[model samples]
Target: MRAITLSEYGGPDDLEPAEFPEPKVAPGEVLVRVRAAGVNPVDWKIAEGLLDALLEVRFPLVPGWDVAGVVEQVGLDVEEFSVGDEVMGYIRKDTVQLGAYAERVAASVRLLARRPAALSWEQAAGLPLAGLTAYQSLERVGVAAGETVLVHAAAGGVGSLGVQLAVARGARVIGTASERNHGFLRELGAEPVAYGDGLAERVRELAPEGVDAALDFVGGGVVDLSQELLRRRDRVASIADPEAVAKGGHYVWVRPDSVDLTVLADLADAGRLDVPVDRVLPLADAAEAWRYSRTGRARGKVVLTVD
Candidate 1:
């Protein structure tokens, strides 16, 4: 199997495709033939040494978090799926160091979910990590039907789904993106706002009564604006900027939940959710993907097509 690995954490130049031994499946796990893998900021964060203290990694660790693939073999205890099942999952937050960057990967059965018939492999691969993050973040904010929710970075990976999921839940959704993605956000059923100086004022202008809930995907003192936009402090949540999250408002850390992913997939299959793929590149072009992801401007998830 070939994968992007780095013995030392650094820039994109450190990333290289190298042959590695195929992973063995443990009990209650399944070996999947990788088809497409999602590239996330977390992947590049690990490669750049930001998560060195938190994540225990062996030498030359793989850097993918989301994968959509076909099950090649199933472990003895894996009863939910067979050898031929098509699956997708958030593989990074599942295992300690191993991830889904290679031609094949062994994933826990509990974390795996069947891909929706209506979605392509690229679209399915984008769902697990970002989808779960958005769902859980909205949950944390107590987004209820008939409420108004403002999502920062609405054109982003998690923000894009946050918009759709909020809309599906009957919330009047307002999303913040660049001017270019305003139409894209509108297509996802959100009233879009361009992020800039006085962004909160702009949202307030759009809704004079104020927003009921606010989810900040983009960090850096945005909570001050979020707090101003929403009346209740408890109704605010931030996925990034944990330090500011506690001081400014509620903190949300992205965690893996199989049930949540299943519900999200159901929403997707029901046409209530949108899984947008920004671009799909070969696995070896991970360096370029990492560079683009670092900009934090991708319309949705960027995926790597695997052989």
Candidate 2:
């Protein structure tokens, strides 16, 4: 297998393309022949040792979690999928090595779901992590139909999906982004609000009474802003801010669940959800993808395609 590896904790420059042995399939896992891998900030953050205290990372690490591919082999006791099944998953394991940025990866069935036929491999790869984050966050806050929900960073990967999913639930969505991305947010069924100054006021302008729920994806004190506009202070969830819990709001850490992933897949198949892909680079260009992700300019998801 060919993979992008990091000899130690560093930046994009540390990533190197090298040959590695194929991973052995464990019981309850399946080996996926990688078609595409989604580029996420956490991939690079993990590369830079940002999650050092939290995760156990080994040397010569492969740093990707989001994958869309075909199942090549099934491990013992696996009955959900078989060879040739198309699947997408957030394949984060307890350890940080042998990931989706390779020719193939072995992931637990618990993390895998049948890929939505409506999405291309690139789009499918982009959905698992960001979609799950948005879905789980919205779920945590209990967003319901006819409610007005505010989503921070609405044009970014997770936020864009958040807007669409909220809209699918029949919730009126108010999303925060730059002026350049306001139109994009509108396409996702959100009333767009420019972030950074008087954000709360702008949201209030749209919903005079106050929003029913809020999702903070950008995390620079947006939880406080959300709390101010939320009818109930606790009806807010933050993926970027851990302080949300202290502020009487919820802080969400996305977990891999086959059921949740399948719901997202169903939404896509029903034409209620769409994955917005900003860029697609070859697997060998993983470093370049990380650079683009670091710039924070991508409108949606960035993906690496494997031939």
**C-alpha-based local distance difference test score of model 2:** 0.95
Question: For residues 1-307, what per-residue lDDT tens digits would candidate 2 score against the true structure?
Answer: 8999999999999899999889999999999999999999999999998999999999889989999999999999999999999999999999999899999999999999999999999999999999999999999999999999999999999999999999999999999899999899988999998998888888888999999999999888989888888899999999999899999999998999999999999999999999999999999999999999999889999999999
Candidate 1 per-residue lDDT over residues 127-232, each given as its tens digit: 9999988888888888999999999999999999999999999999999999999999989999998899889789989899999999889987777788887878
* Candidate 2 to truth, TM: 0.99
State residue 261's C-alpha deviation in candidate 2, in Å: 0.3
Worst 10 residues of 1 by lDDT: 91-100
Which stretches of candidate 2 lie above 4 Å from their native place?
none
Cα-based lDDT for every prediction: 0.87, 0.95
Candidate 2 minimal-lDDT segment of 10 residues? 196-205
